[model samples]
Target: MTHSSDLLPPPGDESAGALRVQNLDLNLLKTFNAVYAEKHVGRAALRLGITQPSVSHALGRLRLLFHDALFVRTGGGVEPTPRAQRLAASIDRSLAILQAVLDEGAQFSPATSRRTFRLYMSDFAESAFLPTLLRELDGRAPGVVIETLHIEENQFNVAIESGRIDFAMGNFPHAFSHFHHCELLQERYVLMMPRRVAERYALDDHFVLDSTVPPALQFIAVSSHPQSTALLEQHGLASRVRVAVPNFMVVPAILYRCDYALILPRTVARAFAPLGEMAAFEIANASTWPVNAYWHRRFDADPGHRWLRALLIELFRIGTREPHESWLAIPPNLRPSALNP
Candidate 1:
C-alpha cells in the first residue's frame, strides 16, 4: 500500500497547491469513495444517483488532484491503485464525520423527514415485522421510507460499516460484537402444523423425536435459520423431512396440504394461528432466543436513526425483562433517552 506521506506534493512549489485536499471539492471525494466501493463506474454512478459520464469526470478531477491514477481499468471493472487503497479508509471516515456534523446542526422531524433507511431482515422477520412497522410509520413518519434487504449473516458488519444498511433486526441467536443492540422481544420455536396433525401430539410434554406423535408426521423444514432445521437433525429425524423451504411464507400452505409441521418462530406462528386452518403448539422446554434490533455505534446519535429506533422499541419491547437472559441486557451506556425516555 502507498504510504500517506507519498501523497504530499513538493513544498514551496506554486503548482502543488491544487493537490491539497482542503482545496478539493467534496463531490470529488464522494465520487471517489463510491467508485472505490463499487469498483465500477456505472455502479458507482447508480449508487451516487449520477450519470456515468459525470462519475468519470469526477474521477478525472480527483486523479489530477491526487496525482495518482487512483483506479486502473480492468476487464470487468476498475481496481483501486495502491494510493487509492491507502486513501479510501481516511476518506470514508472523513465523509462520515462531516455528515454527522451536518446532521447535528440539522433537525429530523419524523412527520416531515423523507429519509430512506435500509434495514436487514429475513423473509421470516419481514413477514412478522414489516406490516406492523409500516402501519406505525404511516401514522408517525409517513414520509420516512423503509427498504428491507435480505443480507447474509456474514455480511452484517460490512453492510452496517459501509452505511449500506441502517439496521439489522431479527432473532439473532448470538451477538455480533462491537455493535449496540437492544432486545425487541423473546421468541421460541413452535410446531405449526395441520390441525389434524397437531391433535395427534400432546402439548403438555417436551418435544421429543418419538412421543405419542402421529405415525405419519412428516416435517417441512424451513432452511432460513439453521437452528430451526438443526433441531430436527439433532433429534435424528432428518430422514423424516419431506420437504424444505427457504422461508415461512409457504409454510401455512404446506401445513394445510399435508401432515407436516414446520419449526418456526412463535411470532410467525402466532400470525398463522388466527388463520384457523392450522394450529400452533409450543414445544415445551424448546430452545428460546431473543429478537434484537442492532445498529452501529457510529450512528447512535443521528436523529432519524434514533427516531426510527425509538419507534421500534416502542412497538416490540413490551412488558418486563425475562430473568437471566444475557442477550436481553442492552448496554447501559447506549442512547438511553431515545430508547426509554
Candidate 2:
C-alpha cells in the first residue's frame, strides 16, 4: 500500500546515498585496489606501504559504505565478492588513467627511470652511434631502454608529427618549421673495400680510378639514400655498380668476401674499419652533409625529450672529445674538409 519512493532514504539524511558519495575518500579506493590485487589484507598493506591495521580500518569503512562484505576470509587468502569484483574492474582502469596524468607532469630522472625511447634511424646512423651510446648508457642510465625503427624518408615527417617517433637521427636536407633539430656532426663520404682488394690490386689508401680497376671494381650501392647513388652517377662511377643492398651494415660483410666497394659516411666507415678486414678512403668529389636529431615542436618543453637531446649532443657534438678523438687520428687528407680548419 506504501509508495516505492517512501522506501528510499529521506533527503539530507546522513545515511543517504548522496552523503556516502560526498564523503568518499579517494585514498580508500587506492587501498581497495591494493587489497583486490593481493587478496590478503596484510599483503595489501605491504604493497601499499601502510600498516595492516590501516588496511583493515579502510576495509571496514568500505563495507559500511557499500552495505556489503566486499571480501571474505578463506584458507588460502581473501576472495572478492561479486560486487567487489565489479567495483575492482572499474577502479583499476580509473587508477591507471589517474597515474598516467600524474606521470605526465612528473620530473624526469634518467638514473631511475624505466622509460623506453623510440627512435627512427638509418642503418648508417645505427652502425655509427649505437656502440658508444650503449656503453655510455650502461654507465649512466642503466634502466633506460632504446628501441630503433628503420627510417623511412618518405614517412619521416608523418611519423614525427604523429608522435610515433620520439627522435630521428640522420641527414635530412629539408627542415620543417614545426619541428626542432640540432646538428650533431658534419659527415663526408668515403669509399670502403676489403683489405685483400687493396693488396691484390696494389691499391694505395688513396685509390685512383684506372682502366684496370674502374671496370672490374664492383660497387655496392645502398638503396636507402638516393643522393649517394646520384653522387656516384655524377662522378661516372654508377655503370660499374653491380650490387645494390638495402642496409649499410651488410656492406662490410659483403666487402669482406668480394671485391665490392661501398661509398659510406666517414663515421660509419670508421666504425667498420676496426674489424681488421676492411679499409676506408676519402672519395673524390663526395658530398658533405650535416647529421641531425629531429623532434616535433610539441616536445620542445618536455623535460624527458630535452634530456635525450642534450645527451645526444653531448656525445656527438662537433669538436666534442668523445667523437673527435676517434676520427682526429685519421690523416688530414682522409678527414672531411668540413671538419678541417
Candidate 3:
C-alpha cells in the first residue's frame, strides 16, 4: 500500500510557479472555491472561465484526494456536503493569506497602472459620490478605470468577497458589517423645499421638524429613500406624503413643480441648493446615516486597492471610524437563482 504523500512532488520546484501549492496545483483550490461560492458546477466553470467538463474532472480529482463526496447534486444545482462545509473556511482563509503575501510585494503606480476597479453602488450613491470621486481621480490616477455595478444590495458582500467587485459604496450598514469598512461621511436627514414653497409655508433655513407641526407642510418621498418616509410615519405624519417617485433622477423636476417638502440626505440636497432650485434644512432629531466605503478584508494588503481607498478617504471622508481588521463574519447571501451565466 502506498501513502498519499508519497506521490507528492518534491518541494521548491521553481518551474512549478505560483500555481503549485505544497504538491498539488492552486487551480484545484480555485475550482473548489468557485464551486462552493456558486453552488453549481456549471456556474463555477463560467466563473473560472473554464469548460464544465474541466470542472467535473477537477471535482473528481478533489474527491479522490479528500476521500469525500464533497458536494452532492440537488434539484436545482448542488449543495455542499458537511465535509465540504468544514473544509471551506480553512481553504478560503489560506488562499486569502497567500494572496495578501503576493500583494505585499506588488508595486502599483496609479499614474501608469491600467487596472480597472469594479464597484457595487446604489443610484443615489452614484450621484452623491461619483462626481467628486471622478474629479479627484482625474488628476491623481488618470489611468485608473472605474466600473460601477448597480446590483442588488444582498449580492454586494459576496461579490466583493470573491474579488468580483473591488468596493461597495453606500448607506448600507446592514450589508457591509462583515467586511472592512470606513465611514466616508455622515449626513443627517433634511427637509428640502423650493424657495417659493419654503416661503409660502413660512419655512426658512432655520426650520426644524418639531411638535408644533404645520398642517400644510406635506412631503415628497423618493421610493429609494424609505428612511425619510419612515421618519414621517414615526412622527404620525403618514398621510402627509403627497408624492412618491422611483429615484432621484426626477427629483429636481418634481421639486420645482410641487409644494411638497422633500426629505433626503443633506449632501445630496446641497447640490441643488447651489443651483438655487431648493434649500435644505436639518430635521431636528432625525436619523443620520453614514455613507461608507467597504472592501473585503483580504484586500487589506493590496497596494492598488489601498491606494484607491486612500484616495476616496482623502477626498470625502469626514468621520474618524477606521477600517476594522476583523474577519469574524462571512458574506451572508445565497447565490441568487437568476445569477446564471
Q: Is candidate 1 or candidate 2 better by TM-score?
A: 2
Candidate 3, residue 117: CA error in Å?
A: 1.2
Model 2: weakest 10-residue lDDT segment is: 332-341
Looking at model 2, residue 330 earns an lDDT score of 42
Mark the 10 consecutive residues where model 1 has the least summed lDDT: 332-341
What's the C-alpha lDDT at position 231 in model 2? 66
lDDT of 3 by residue, 1-341 (tens): 54333333446534434433466778888999999999999999999999999998888767666656787878988888898999999999989998977765796788877889998876666766676677767888898889998777677667887899899888776675669888876666777777777677777567677665678788777888888888777777779888888777777777777767777776666544434456556566796678888889999988899899898777667683422111101122321111111
> Candidate 3: TM-score?
0.60
**Residue 298 alpha-carbon offset, candidate 1, angstroms:** 1.0
* Regions of model 2 farther than 4 Å from truth: 1-106, 206-215, 319-341
lDDT of 2 at 113: 77
Show model 1 residue runs off by greater than 4 Å.
1-106, 173-176, 199-210, 319-341
Could you list the CA RMSD of all candidates, in the order they appear?
18.2, 10.1, 19.9
Which candidate has the highest lDDT of all? 2
Off by over 4 Å in 3: 1-105, 320-341
Model 2 alpha-carbon miss at residue 229, Å = 2.1
RMSD of 2: 10.1
- In TM-score terms, candidate 2 sits at 0.63
Q: For model 3, what is the C-alpha lDDT against the true structure?
A: 0.73
